[model samples]
Target: MTPADCPEKPVVDLRSDTLTRPSAGMRKAMAGAEVGDDVYGEDPTVKRLETVAAEMLGKPCALFLPTGTMANLVAFLAQTRPGDSIILSESAHPIHYENANLSMVAGLLPCVIHDALGKFTADQVEQRIVREDDPHLSWTTLVSVENTTNRGGGACWELHEMESIAALCRRHGMRLHCDGARIFNACAVTNIEARYYAKCCDTLCFCLSKGLGAPAGSLLAGDPETMHKALRFRKMLGGGMRQSGILAAAGLYALEHHLGDLAEDHRRARRFRQALEAEGFEFCLPSPTNILYIRVENSLRAVKTLKRRGVLTLAHGQDQIRAVFHRDIDDKAMEDAIECFKQALALPR
Candidate 1:
């Protein structure tokens, strides 16, 4: 069942960061946004948002799309042709959540990297490259890495590890695309600029709706040629929109104001995990940011019981319940959530 299946309406929804609503300031920005047709490249607010995103991410250009999933798919479509193989971690969002768009729509063969951590080393990627011109094998044309990997308990990639993978992709003459939906969270934790990571890859994308607290939108940044190709693919994929500056304005406001607050989200998540651990609760990994995966005997049962106690979460697997902290979960809510967890799990079975 979905998050909506909770028997009692949840007061503290920790299902995902995408649940964050726009603040009054962000809503004001969207309300007053100057708009024009974005498909014709005449939307002023969208242009400003793209320019800001490109400069911050150290890319030559950027494009705004409706969803993070489209931004990623456009990256793949722009870089590789049919029959090409792309390398990605087994725990990647595209592999699990994106409905096989990589294969069915991009017409690319995926070379899966079986890593439990949702990250792969440069050496592992180098070994997967198809170096031969044999007509039998699909040439490895692209490599993708996710920052603050979702399924791997929100583990952030080490800068050195990313650099090594980028170097390998450059040496192999392959395109490197970063599925950086939560890249800003990684930046907040590491105190590293987003541009540094962008420099190491051919293209990068970040979502406005996730931790950034925008209502909707994502941006993909790259050089002129790649972005031009991405623009075309975005249109082909029906991702083009008219008067999208309203949404773009919200994204711009998020980058300007909501970015710095990400640290607090991280702190709240760590605090939640720490309190739970003291109560004899188990976590799958150390949460460096806002995502936490709690290990339980039955994740589905835990989720249902937690919902009844005014807490909400997602079942990550049969034995893992996932909770994500965002702007909506304040100090009071966090305390209530902890109490709900202690009470739900301490129940007599």
Candidate 2:
């Protein structure tokens, strides 16, 4: 059944930060946004948003795309030729969640490195690089990493580790791309500026729709030359939008208002984790940010029970349930969620 077909609205939705609706202020901004065809680079508000995003990330330029998937795809298209290989963490969103666009759209082979926390070492990246002399192996042309890794229970990568990988990529003439869908959350927890993280990669994409709470948008930032190529790829991929300032306005509002509030979501997540632990639950990883993965005896049962109890969550695996916090859910909802979880865990195995 579809969500619209459901009789009840969830009292607390822990499914994902993507479920957040734009605030009233954001709606007003969107309505008042001045518009021109973004495809022609005439949309002033989109240009403003792009300029602000580029400045924040310390990139020469940025492109506003409809979704993070498109942002990542465009980056790949700009960076790699067909048959080139890219290395990513085994649980990375691009490899596991983006419908294999890397191979299908970019025609790039993937080499995955398995890690418990979704952070890979420079040594692992070096080991995965195929020798350029070997005609049988796809040359590793790019390395991608995810920050506040979705499947890693919102784990953030250490800055030094990322710098090491970036240095290795540079030394080997390989480009590094960051799938930073929840990058702000990482920055919030680590007290690191977004620019430092951006400086570690050749290109990076971050979602405005996730914890940023924009209605829809993602930005791909990089050196001007790469972004110029990405702009073409975005058009080729049907991401060209006319009068896109309406959406860009929401993104701008989100960046200005919601960026700082992300730490509150992290705080709520930690409280939720503590509550779950008190109810005899174990977690797959310590939630340093807004996403939490609870180890359950039967994830299906837990999900069903939580749904019936007016709380929404996702089954992460056969035995893990995933909960994500966002701006939409409040302190009262958090309390209700804790109560719901308590009752759900009390159910028979």
Candidate 3:
């Protein structure tokens, strides 16, 4: 007995930008969706969505997954065996947010490097790969990169730099995996097609529920062999859902309409940054994508103040906060949030 994936759809939830409910057309499509049990690979709608994603990403195959974390874990499990090592930035979602699921599922070890700007060059990646002569070390078998790196304030990787890193990985007999959860935002901000970004990685996962405004789902794309492996791993993780077309419908709707809206999100983020600066709040770095990090004195108090004012954001640490702009957070919310910041700063220091 499986409960329908979209039992209830939210309309506007900007807390994480993943709360966006399906659009009206998406709901209608989901209600009348063509579905089958996905465990047997017989779900026509799921197959169609997978095919569409694969073709869009220039990959031979793709897997529809229940969540971005599962998509990333499945790819890692397929790429690395126990005791194999992989290099990734310290800010990678897999390292900080996935609760060590990488080690749990793939038996993979992490070699972390700091990437303050969210873009790691070829030299940085090559430096992390252990040399063949180093017998005392674990073999570095994979290089993982995150686009619009969450901790880097949604920064994007340049295409040329990524190509260079991919070539470096190939020379070392290492595969490259991209955790591109907000890749559509990257694509929208950079004005680049998604396939061009896919060219630099052996496998990649992108979320439909994030900036794309889908209710639930992410996609992992790769060559045929890897994708087949991922499909099997997906089921092993108990992610096989019946009638998943309800979720797939929203993904399709997002791909069609919401991709362009990410630029608007970026615009609003820039506006918010300007307002924050006007109130004497400085940024640690430039706001590139829809995510911006604010350098503040009392992070927790600021969060509480914003929450009280009907605004929501995350407190990263004692000195910094993260404010994410999404399609649902319009200009008015941005202004209200800025006022909240100013009011919070005026509190007893």
Candidate 4:
């Protein structure tokens, strides 16, 4: 059908899943949440959220932070000393999205491994490890991996590979951390429980703001000793909250009600990919989760065009436009998006 034949619809927002607004149920939970000063460790709702997150992830302890960035950075700060080094993929979030916090705040050296899919083998990490006898080199103290890597088009790392890396870190007297901001998405695709992934790392975090549909919050989990240190670093970084149980309440609601439907987002993503392919468009890579990267000659031009047609998206780089699916997008938005894509592709070069 042509533009005239399509029904009127709200804007199709495929820019990022973080754009998802809190659902009514989540808002209700937030409204009714028990509150106290979390910094003083008196918040009942925050405690419950942390307890539930720790149990589900199989970590002995958990801490609630305002954002995933804080959770990831606190983990790094807690596990390593200043001048220590970290190993992470070129596409890891801390490398790009965290505004150089690892260096400026944590004061650690970053040793990067390049992988287009945002995965590095245990062998790659072993090669990056510094020789302790070499007094001139900073010690490699930590290795971090992203699950459903953001800049890598939401790619998930294999559990076996993670186990290998964890073993290698243990042998080298280093810690393994998973930047699992979208880990639940990985779980949906791989049929793996969050606890198994937690078992492969000394620390990891997952965001409720992204696919979980919370307005704001992230949980960092690890062994009690590491998490004890992490709590101190979180306070140092100003992550202590006064009454964040209101936000934690949304997280609790999401975990209880939203997890089972994540696979549906994956299905919609696949359907969107197939639909776009039928229009002669191509994705930069096939993602198993909600994120998709469409290849275009000029990403900026395509983004502007799609925006004018009432479909919102992000430009991954110079040549790829990214679209992410979340609970906010529905069948109507998906159909409208396809129609807009058909029209956008018909534009004069």
Angstrom error of the Cα, residue 73, model 1: value is 0.3
Rank all candidate structures by their TM-score, best first, as comma-separated numbers: 2, 1, 4, 3
Cα lDDT for residue 247, candidate 2:
99
Which parts of model 2 are misplaced by more than 4 Å?
4-7, 347-349
Task: Give all TM-scores, in the order shown.
Answer: 0.97, 0.98, 0.93, 0.96
The reply for model 4, stretches above 4 Å from the true place, is 1-10, 347-349
Inter-residue clash pairs, candidate 2: none
lDDT to native, each model: 0.92, 0.91, 0.82, 0.90
How far residue 142's Cα lies from its native spot in candidate 3, in Å, is: 0.5
How well does candidate 3 match the true structure, expressed as C-alpha RMSD?
A: 4.3
Measured by lDDT, the strongest candidate is 1
Give RMSD to native, each candidate.
1.5, 1.4, 4.3, 3.9
lDDT (tens digit, per residue) of candidate 4 on 14-120 = 98899889989989999999999999999999999999999999988999999999999999999999999999998899999899999999999999999988989
TM-score head-to-head 3 vs 4, winner: 4
Deviation from native of the Cα of residue 223 in model 2, angstroms = 0.8
lDDT of 3 at 98: 91
Ranking by lDDT: 1, 2, 4, 3
In candidate 3 the C-alpha lDDT for residue 276 amounts to 67
For model 2 the TM-score comes to 0.98
